[model samples]
Each structure stands twice: as structure tokens, then as C-alpha cells.
Target chain A: MTIKILGTGCPKCKQTVDIVNKAVAKLGADIKVEKVEDIIKIMEYNVISTPVVVVDESVKIKGRVPTMSEITALIQAS
Target chain B: MFDWLIYFSDWLIYDVSGLSEGSRLGTALSFFVYDVIKILILLFLISFIMGIVNVYFPVEKLRNYLNSRKLYGLEYLFSAIFGAITPFCSCSSVPLFIGFVQGGIPLGVTFSFLITSPLVNEIALALFLGMFGWKVTLIYAITGILLGTFGGFILGKLDLKDWLTDWVKDIMAKTYEKGDTVTADSINFIKELPLISREAWHIVKGVLLYIIIGIGIGAAMHGYVPENFFEQYLGGGQWWTVPAAVIIAVPMYANAAAIVPVIQVLVVKGVPLGTAIAFMMSTVGLSLPEATLLKKVMTFKLISVFFLVVTVFIVASGYLFNLVL
Candidate 1:
């Protein structure tokens, strides 16, 4: 599964990626995480608020940083 | 071809031409000009964008939504969103805050807007992405919004009705921009172009001064300051440094966009990212002007809460960055 962060590379978006990686590593799960910083492509996701988290092409979280445990739960539910 | 000319000249004087110690004076002069030009451009660009954001964005609508409390975290979320787009310096946001309060907006929600406005913005976002890459930028944005939301909510719960200044209360009772739609106000594109140009010009006119001020200070720090002093003293080792830095920074404001480059320089000189970030938050997010302006509307007690909320957020963010980033 792929986890993509959508935003024009602000600090919050960067933290989300870091937290996600840690969560994924903690779970011993192999998932690809990408930081998408291009504004035009981020707009395509129909996201106005930034630091959006997209898992498998569907946005899972928008405008908020999810906790590591919350992210682990999200990945498991997916 | 044009780019190569400037590059070649710079190389020739600094590297190739290799004038002995006698020509060091000339090289230093040229270097000063270069730094001055860069700072000027940055200030001009940021100020221009500020004007556009002020003129264009439908902020009153957003203010209304935040005031209405239509969603649980929605106001906080939107406050973050709008905050990013409109890059107002800490002092500049005070007038807007007064406007928001007078529009019947809740103080807590307005506080959220105030908190996020300085910490996260388009220019800073772009600068962070360009300098530190995507990961660092994302973390700053998310944490900034969270702080704003939490701070706003806490202030809302406090309900300090008596804390407001009498003049501000009077201003709140008076209506100024009634029934005026943000977009409905027609600007004469032809005449306004010059006016916009003039505003842009005036904004840029002081660029040389700001650049001189920013770089004179930055270069001295670059040249004179010990490389590991910040890291060893405040960032990595000292537990109290985070809160201290936040407290120290609130009274001294500098635009985040301008400060990022300085932070980048600091980090290069071995300053810890956490400490640098705390300083950045303080300098941009809280300043003497903002506190003085807030005094116009809020009593000392309310101002105390406001400072407490922001200072805590800055400290938390610094520690969070230390742990995560």
C-alpha cells in the first residue's frame, strides 16, 4: 500500500510523513510513503486544507496530524 | 546567457581574479550588495503577496464561519487554512483581529486565527520546502494548526467578558463595513494597477533597510557566534531552553519568511533544529507590537492567558520537533 502526503511542503506535512514512517516501522509493516509537494497535483485531490494524508489514492486524513497509534489503526482497517 | 554574466563576474572577483589582501575591501563591498539585493527581493515579494491576500481572500466569510462554530474542529481547521494563505506578520494581524472581534466573532476562535497566522504562511511554507525539504515543512504546518485550535478552544472556555477594553467594546458596537461583500468592491484594474504598483513600490522601497538590518545581524551571527553554542546550550542539552526561547521570542517579532533563511544559516552552524524552530515561532508568532495591540482590546489578565497559551504551544512544538524530526 502507498501512503501519500498532499501539500506544498509545509512543516506539518513533513511531520505527518515522519510520524507515518515511524508508525509503519513500529508495526513492522512494509508500506511505501511518498511526500507530494507539488501544489497543482495536490489540488487534483480536491483538497483545499493541506497536510492531507492519502492511503492507496483515497485521502484518509485532511488538515490534521494523526497520531502513530491512530495511523496504525487506520492502516490495519484499510 | 544573462545569468552566466552575473555568475562569471561574481566568480572572477571572489575566486578567479584573486586580488591579494589589498582588494579584500572591494570583495567585501560587493558581497554586501549581493546580500542586500537578496534580502530586498525577499521582503518585496512577501509584502506583495500580503497585499494580494488582503485584497483578494474572502476572510470575513471565513471569520463568520469560525464565529458560527459550525463544526467541532472545523473552525480551527479553517483558521489554519486561511492562516497559511494570508501571510500577515504578527503585528499586522492585530488590526484584523480587532476587525474580527468587532464583527461579533468569538475571542477564542479569533485567537486561533491569530496564533496560526504568523506561524504558518505561504512564504514560510515555500521557503521551508525549498530549504529543508518536504518532511520538515509538513511537520511545522500540522503542529501549528493543532496549537492554534487547542489554544483557541481553551481561551473560549475561559470567557473573559470583563477583560475587554472599553474603547474596543465601543468599537465592537460600531459597524464599519456593513453589507459589503469582499469581492463586490470593484477595483479599477487600470487605475488600480498603478495603485497596486505604487503599494508594491512603497513596500519594496524599504527593502534595502530591512535587508541591511536582517543581513547585518545574520552575517555577524554567521561570523562571530560559536558554531556549537546554540546546540549545546539551548537545543539539545537544556530542558528549560524551549520555554525560555519561546518567552524570549514573543516580544521580538520578525516575519517567518525572512527568519527561515536565518534559521537555515543557524542550523548550518550547528544549531539544533528544535531550538531554531522555537526561536522562529517566537519571532514570527508573538512580538511586542502584537502584545501592545492586543492591550487595546484585552485586559492584562486576558493578555496573560494569550501569552501563556502561545508560549506553551511554542515550547510544545519545539519539543515535538526534537522528538520527531
Candidate 2:
């Protein structure tokens, strides 16, 4: 499964990346994490703020950072 | 109404039954505790609500819509208003500015958006309401919006595209090479209650320290600063205080959330509302750090012009408020 994290490299976005990466590592799941920073790309999802996570093709989160537990649950759901 | 808060804080911070309860230290402790709670609650509640609202207004769509607008004034106004929701620090804002300029939105509209980002944000609004009440927040927000709208329109009319970095200016030159919009893996916000809660939690964690420190400073100042020290000198009647406030604040770097309480102290100590707000806006809107960071995407001339315009208006705003409010 592909996990997309949307951010503009702001501090919150960076934190989300770290947590999501850790969650992916701990789960030992075959998942791809993509960081979307381009404005043209991020807005296509109708996201105004950064640090959003997308599980597969669905936007699971936007605008706030998620904890490792939340990240794991999101990955499992998708 | 807040006596219980003060008393509770006094009991916690010092000898509650002692004569020192009426002393400066005691008063400062009480003020700090009362204000800290009030500000944090306001910050958390308002930030959560704003986060929810932001989901509805993505920046990319806003840019495309602005590009399509033939009405320059309306476009600028809309862009300026968008600043209220586009929650990016100055560092991230430059990228968005580049995106808007390349996306065929007018430079003025993009500039308005950039300028408004610091001025009309939830942080600033919450702090203003927490310190000075709704009236000042409304005025400050309106002034910020007007500054962005008018400043951008005039700059747009000047056609200063060449002032941007050659690369950024060339993006405008290559305007017709627009890329097709990409679709995202999307989920409905309504079904994402957990995500929403996480978002709120994140905001509270991010800002809690700033709120405490700011309130702490305000409380201490209210309690300990010598009486008539600020009011006698920096008070509303001082002709030069407003301008000086802006000048002093322009170099410091702090978000609106962290600095509001300090500004509150300044106002309470007899500094005029206009001067205090001018300091707030200048510090948040025209910091040296922000200017230094923007150098990556903008040319010296454009940066100078941007700074000059924002500073002049902010200083003027301070004086106007002092005179009228």
C-alpha cells in the first residue's frame, strides 16, 4: 500500500514525516511513503494545511500531525 | 469574576494567608495564572475550530480561481482574505508565493496573500481577544486585510515583476506552460473524526508553551513593572511612541501567539493601543528573519519594496489607532 504525506516542509510537516516513518518501520508492512510538497500537488487534494496523510488513494488526515498509534491505525484501516 | 482564579493561583504560587498576598510578587503570580488559563483555553478552542475550517479551502484551488479572475480588486481582496486561513510560517509562505505567481495569479494578489498570512491569522486573533477583547481583534484584522488588499493592488498596478528573482520572474514569463492538476487520495473530513481530534491535539501541543510564556510575561509586567513607568512615557499621548514601537519590533522574531501577552503588558502599562498593535504587527509581519528567508525566492528590490510598504502601513496603523481608538 502507498502512504502519502502532504506537507510544505514546515515544522509540523517534518514531525508528521518522522512519526509516520516510524510507524511504517515498526509495523513491518510493505508500504511506500511519499512526501508531497508541491503546492500544485497538495491543493489537488483540497488540503489547505500541511502534514496530511493519505492511505492508498484516500485522504486519511490533513493539517495536523498524527502520533505513531494514530499512524498505525490509519495504515491498518487503509 | 476572575477573583477565584487569582486566589487559586495565589494560593498555589505563594503564601496565600501572608501579608505578601498584596505585594507585587503576589499580584504578578495571580495575574499570570489567571491570564495563562484564559489564553490557553482560547488558543486551543479557536485553533481547533480554525483547523476544521481550513479543510474546506485548499491553497491550490484558491490560486487557480484567483488566476481566472479578471477583477483585479476582487482578486486581491480574496487573496488577502485567504491569508487568514493559509497557515504557513514565513519560511513555507515563500514557496506558496512562488506557486501563486507562476500559477498566473497577479503578483499583487499573491503579495496580498503573503502579507495577510502573518496579520489575520487565528493566533493573532486569539491573542488579541484574550488580551484586549473582541473589539481590538476585529480592528487589527480589518487593518491587516486592508493593508494586504491595497498594498498588493498598488504593487500589481506598478508591474514590478522584474524585481522578483530571475527564476521566479521567468516562471511568470513561462505562464502558459501550466501543468495539469493532479488528483489526490482523498477522504471526507466528516468521516475523519480521529484525524480532526489529532489535529486539535497537535495544535495545542505546538502552542501551549508560547501561551504560558507570553501570559507569564504579561502577568509579571502587570504586577511588577513600576507604575506610570510605561504610561508616563510610552502612553497614548506620546507622539513618537507608535513609530518607535514599530521600529523596535521589526527586528525581533516571534509568532503572534507567543508575543501577545507581552504586548498586553505594554498596553496595560499605559502604552497606547495603536503603539502596542503596531509593535505586534511589525514584529510578526516584518521581522528580519522573514525578510532574510524570503531572499531565496525574491530579488533584493522586490523584498525592499515589500518590506517598505508593510512597515509604512503598520506604522501608520499604529498612529491611527492611537489617535482614534
lDDT agreement with native, every candidate: 0.66, 0.75
Worst 10 residues of 1 chain A by lDDT: A39-48
Prediction-by-prediction clash tally = 17, 4
lDDT of candidate 2 over A1-78, digit per residue (tens): 998988767788898899999999999999999998765576565444456788886777655677788889988876
DockQ of each: 0.01, 0.24
Best-matching candidate per DockQ = 2
lDDT of 2: 0.75
Runs with alpha carbons beyond 4 Å of true place in candidate 1: A1-78, B1-12, B15-39, B64-69, B87-95, B121-142, B166-183, B186-194, B220-229, B254-262
A22 Cα displacement, candidate 1 (Å):
62
